[model samples]
Target chain A: MEQDLSAPGILTSQLDQAIGWARKYSIFQYPFVTACCGMEFMSVACSHYDIDRFGAGFPRFSPRQADVLMVVGTISHKIAPVLRRIYDQMAAPKWVVAFGVCTCTGGFYDNYATVQGIDTILPVDLYIPGCPPRPETVLEGLMLLQKKIQAQGRRA
Target chain B: MDLAPILSDIEALCGAPLSARGAGSDTVLTVPPAKARAAVEFLKAKHGFNVLVDLTCVDYQGFGKGTQNVSPAPEGRRFKLVYRLMALDAGTGLIKARLALDSWVDGESVPATIKDLFPAADWLEREVWDMFGVRFADRPDVKRILMYPEFTGHPLRKDYPIKKRQPLIGPADASARERLSPADLRPRIVE
Candidate 1:
């Protein structure tokens, strides 16, 4: 068996190429919106934000059918449990983009009802912070998560 | 106390002590617990506090520890009950009556039930009682709202502990690990 010194770099380059292809492909995502940020997510999906440019055309409704999990609002104590279960149910090679300050860190709801951040419950790849972030910010985070997924040879 | 004579005329009812404060567009009433239902009857049948806008609580024990619960206070007799009502009549205005009660005390006399007049009061009263530990003598279901049923203490009280932990932050050492883990990770399994 010959040990090739450049094989890892080639694999990495191939992985990068695969990620570029994935970024150009449509991504099915489950949006978990609980608060004001959900409105911005709507705006991104609308003509104003125009998410179609990134190849993420329509957001999927069912978790079983989606490749990305987008947490778009506040996760409360009552709701966090459900969110965790949903994250677990998503297929492997899945990516999560925490899409608002409330979802990323509980925002202004400094109380028991709201979870401080989604990371405590689910492993988040990207954290998008804003009381209700601009749709552009959400799209940017989505793009970053796609890049991260490419590095892992996964489709987001 | 006796709104009986005033009931005959709806306009005259507003002139009573209930609406005397008359803050903003909403008329106000301060009623004792015993006559709460009667006041509602008069308002619905005569004057217009008819809509039953909202029934909520105000904890007077100040801000305290535990969960981020504000509406409920642990103080036995220092809680306040607020009832918001509106005139269903398109032309009529809005009204609010705020009643102060100390129903948190186990034996301290709780004001009579408002549920009889507004069956809707049942859910609202239950919510207040569940959150604030206020006793609404006649409210049918006084269980937990906005908190787990097994929740230890009333969070809205001014003395509950406040702890802020950064999300997804793991413990730094073995002590932290032991604190977080259900079993002693240090214990070895000898096969």
Candidate 2:
């Protein structure tokens, strides 16, 4: 049973680090796009911005398969229940990123129709604030989410 | 471009001359509620007003209420259903007609519907019913078009509260679980 205890500790730590790194890179995104911000989201995912470089190129339509929920536009009160159900359907270790000002704080639609913020219904892990955030900002948000995932993996 | 020749013909059919007002290339004809359908039919069939551009309603609740010195309708008339008809021919342009109706307090019907004459009035009349609580008589499929079925109150009315919220919780039958307000839950109680 005395099988090199020092070597085993180093190998275990290295393996954990490798697992965390892998988890940080691979993110299956569910884009819950509703309005004009979807156009900006397209630009980010397209060839010019190419979200594939960060390993989040594959967009999962079904919430069950997705690890990240990218809420992209204005969510009206009528659609809130649907959004909530989608968030609930997502598997565990899930993350939510509010992609635009509408998802963050309802943008200019401060009316009875629009939801004030998606965070009231869904737990938001990141907020990318803009009327429709630029592709560069979206990339930065992705990087930030990666760091968060790495930190969470380290803790786990 | 003189509509007097056509106006005399409409007056003969309607039994009264329609009060006409000109705005640029368009002429607006104000017809009584009783003669509204006949007037619309005559204009469409004879005057070549082929397209029903838009049909809507206006609530005159706040028109004569305050210090605003804007033009007000006669005492009891509270709503106006407007129909915009467009003649898409090379020379012909547009005609707008308005039919005034009393308030919905005594539960009186608006009497006629042009849905038979113009198929486009189907959704338009439904929208008017949804927004202004004006019921179009003889129309079978009169239901809320823009708003959800569960939504209460005509939202476009001037008297409607702007901040009023009707947040639906769960399924329509699951209204019992809602603890927001007694009034909100009252619809679920089928007594």
Candidate 3:
């Protein structure tokens, strides 16, 4: 075998097709909402901030079909197992976006019950920070996720 | 406050006797533990009090011996099972049920799993179990919820001591690392 090994990694047409498919498909998010931040997540789903603009319309009540798990509120130790069960039920290639200061880091509830972060239980890809983040920030995170998918071009 | 009227109404519906007592703002109904679910159902369906606010237990020992009549029995009879309920719609009236958590039968637990009536009681019951150590029979995942699996003791109990100390694995002492010679960093080769 000849030793010409300096070739650039090429993205095939099939890889481009995969990226297109990911963008066209809507993200079914299993929102593990509790406490104050949960209310803000509901606002994002409502009229003004309609999250559907970024192909993330339907919030799936069931975890089996969901593509993303949005942990929107503070996870206390009491509810941590419940949250884990919900996360485990979601399909593969599932991404977790830790929404708000409470979900990303336990916020002011640095006591026994509150978990410092969602990452302790599940692998988190994105961190959105705010006491309770606005709907616009959530929409921005969705756009960032779409860009990340486009960059990967192929699923790992 | 009007215990007689309510007890008479309940007796009319179900022939079994019922008793009522005053505990602060709560009108506590004392019924046989076996009839607890039936009593709650009658109170909710017929007498209003739709919302189940909280279900918890209080250990009367901390309050002092013979201070409160909430528990009349001695020894293990000191625990009280408190169920707070509220009307859902127009009435908005509140009612409570207080039962002596004193177990007569061996290996038996109190306020027996209200999960069948309200699944939301699962967490509330777990909280009671975690704090007061009041056992709820047939709880699905009855493990400690607020505390880690290996946590030594419950914090909420009156007797539980609160103290702060360094964790098992204390923060890395950088000075200890710096004191180590170059040879110490490298793996030792046995001759």
Best by DockQ: 2
Preferred candidate (lDDT higher): 1 or 3: 3
Cα DockQ of the candidate 3 complex: 0.05
Decide which is better by DockQ, 2 or 3: 2
User: Could you say which candidate leads in TM-score?
Assistant: 2
- The C-alpha lDDT values of all candidates are 0.61, 0.73, 0.63
Q: What CAPRI class is candidate 3? A: incorrect
Docking class of 1: incorrect
Worst 10 residues of 2 chain B by lDDT: B182-191
The window of 10 residues in a row where model 1 chain A has the poorest summed lDDT is: A147-156
What is the lDDT for B118 in model 2? 92
How does model 2 score on DockQ? 0.09
| lDDT of candidate 1 over A8-91, digit per residue (tens) | 687767766776576546677798877778888889988887887877767888888887788888877767668888887888
Candidates in order, interface RMSD in Å:
13.8, 15.0, 15.0
Which one wins on lDDT? 2
TM-score of predicted chain B versus true chain B for each candidate: 0.54, 0.74, 0.61
Better of 2 and 3 by lDDT: 2
Cα lDDT tens digits for candidate 2, B1-191: 45667777877876875577764346666777777788788878877777887888777766855776774454566677777776566454434332221222212556488889899898898988888788888965678887777788887787778766565542222213312232321111111
